[model samples]
Target: MRASPADIESICLSLPEVELGISWGDRPTYKVPRGAKGRGFLLYRAPGKTAIDPVSGDMFTDLLVIQVADEMTKRTLVQDPQSPFFTIDHFNGYNAVLVQESRLGELERDQLVEIIADAWATKAPPRLVREYFANR
Candidate 1:
């Protein structure tokens, strides 16, 4: 089954202390509280020259940027040729992966949940992360 944008929003908001914030003008961003600051864990990316479809040479209009714990985690997600996760030159050296909203169906709903939850853990306070995992 295909996961929709609504599914993404729902999964992000379900995490502990997550907040919906507007970023890059009007794009939706999910952030987790850390002390006095809220760190973004996931966001809808705006189409630009950075990320484009090689085949069509067109900017991707429906991309989602999801944070990861480290470069290893980012590589693991995007290294698989069949994985919908990917990265562009603009994101090199960044601990995140980009996936088109349209390709979300390539992952199972549970898989989607796991990734989003993982993204949350990456930006969530250490105590919150420990508590969240401890309860689970």
Candidate 2:
């Protein structure tokens, strides 16, 4: 029941103006335009050598990096032991959290949907945000 890459892609693309791109020409990344700039809100990030996966004694191949509204939100999510969110030293003070693919089953689909929507809203332009909220 773990969330798959297909789930992430569909959710991200469902948001207005989100585009599929690659991180370093490999990992999938989802971004939204902010004025003339494109901002990435959700990205597929693999654990680096600095962050070892305790279960495999190696780096994790499927970590999802999701942008949050602020550091407080990031801290709150990662600090909750029941939450599947986590972070590494590389993301210290960053306004994002990492969720492993294997642990996605711990979250319901609606939970993932809400997270994706919130992540998009956080990176979207003010005009887009206004339109999105107005339509809701």
Candidate 3:
């Protein structure tokens, strides 16, 4: 099951200045606008690490599952700049990252919500959310 696009939109709305976007695997993503740090919703994904871009305070994503932890060298699956594409972990690996652009979208709101919802269902933290949801 995939994430619903509307849920993706909801997540985006949860953040400030964040607009809906498509992720690497065509998953829903949020586009942070300039000045979002000042006005965008507060981010709580992962904290406490060497700041890579001090000016932005955004961590440079790497391949070691550090997108939620730390910065490390990473390989992107995205190839064509004209299209949404991205890959991770050598040529073929268990984990991968998708590249989606919030700047553009051909999908509709309802459709987006549905897709995002599905994606969120399988989102990582792996055994975390699933276990929590089950216990709930």
Candidate 4:
């Protein structure tokens, strides 16, 4: 039931018009095509100063940044103690959550899929969103 990086990539790319791009530090970012550029919905984060482990003071190397529909959703996810979703000060106002890949085992595969799909919907073109749901 645990999700892997491959599962994340597969679930993301399965959505309509999703594209893969390299982000800062050469991290893999998943986005939905919109116009001249795509809007990123998910990203594999490189270890940085802002997201260090409180216990070890070490940068987290396995972080995944997943976009949410809004700030409310971001707060809801990160506030839930049982949820694997979290956030750092760097994302104080951003509509996204950080999940360590190592902690992905806390979530079921279906949950992972749904999360990625929702992320896609938030950034996917409106026409694409309507069409995708209409066909489903």
RMSD of 4: 1.6
Cα lDDT, all candidates: 0.88, 0.82, 0.34, 0.87
Give per-model TM-scores.
0.92, 0.87, 0.27, 0.92
Ranking by TM-score: 1, 4, 2, 3
Say which candidate scores most in lDDT.
Answer: 1
User: Candidate 3 — which residues are off by over 4 angstroms?
Assistant: 1-85, 89-92, 95-97, 123-136
**Worst-scoring 10-residue span by lDDT in model 4:** 31-40
lDDT of 1: 0.88
Better of 1 and 4 by lDDT: 1
Count of backbone clashes for each model?
0, 0, 28, 0
Each prediction's RMSD over C-alphas, in Å, is 1.8, 2.3, 12.9, 1.6
lDDT of prediction 4: 0.87
lDDT of 2: 0.82
User: Model 1 off-target regions past 4 Å?
Assistant: 24-26, 34-36
Q: Candidate 2 on 1-136: residue-level lDDT in tens? A: 4455468878888788889776645876788972347688998885589567878798988788999989988888899999999988988978889998878888877788888888999989989978987886
Output the lDDT of residue 40, model 2.
Answer: 85
Q: Which ten residues in a row have the lowest lDDT in candidate 3?
A: 63-72
Residue range 21-115, candidate 1, lDDT tens digits:
86667887898883348888899899999999999999999999999989999899999988899999899988999999998888888889988
